[model samples]
Target: MSYRQKQLVMQYAEINNVLDFRLKPELKEALNNIHKQLRKLDDDRERIYLEYSQKLA
Candidate 1:
């Protein structure tokens, strides 16, 4: 994942731990959005790696 994405993940984890079973609505929404971005970044990285490996083969 990208640097910003990594940071967001860390923040999300920290917030989750701190909030435990009581999370605010806005924070939950933000976490969901970050998760979406992280998924997209992961997909993009996988696609690029696949293309690179195919070129080598």
Candidate 2:
């Protein structure tokens, strides 16, 4: 990979790890709420991402 690509990949990984650690509890709570609200939904991953993205925006 190019240097810039490598740098961006590393930065993304670091940010993802930090966000994972810092927001894990809140993410879990959001997931639980989503599950409760939409019992028929089968995709937890997408649901969590959508919820978190909405919250971040």
What is the C-alpha local distance difference test score of each model?
A: 0.80, 0.55
Please give the clash total of every predicted structure, in order: 0, 0
Can you give the lDDT of residue 18 in candidate 1? 57
**Tens-digit lDDT track for model 1 on 1-57?**
578777978887876775554546677777788789888888899999999999999
Q: Candidate 2 at 17: error in angstroms?
A: 0.2
The best candidate in terms of TM-score: 1
Which residue pairs show collisions in model 1?
Answer: none
TM-score quality measure for candidate 1: 0.72
Worst 10 residues of 1 by lDDT: 18-27
TM-score per prediction, in order, is 0.72, 0.31
lDDT of candidate 2 over 1-57, digit per residue (tens):
245445545554554565465556665555555445444333555778799999999
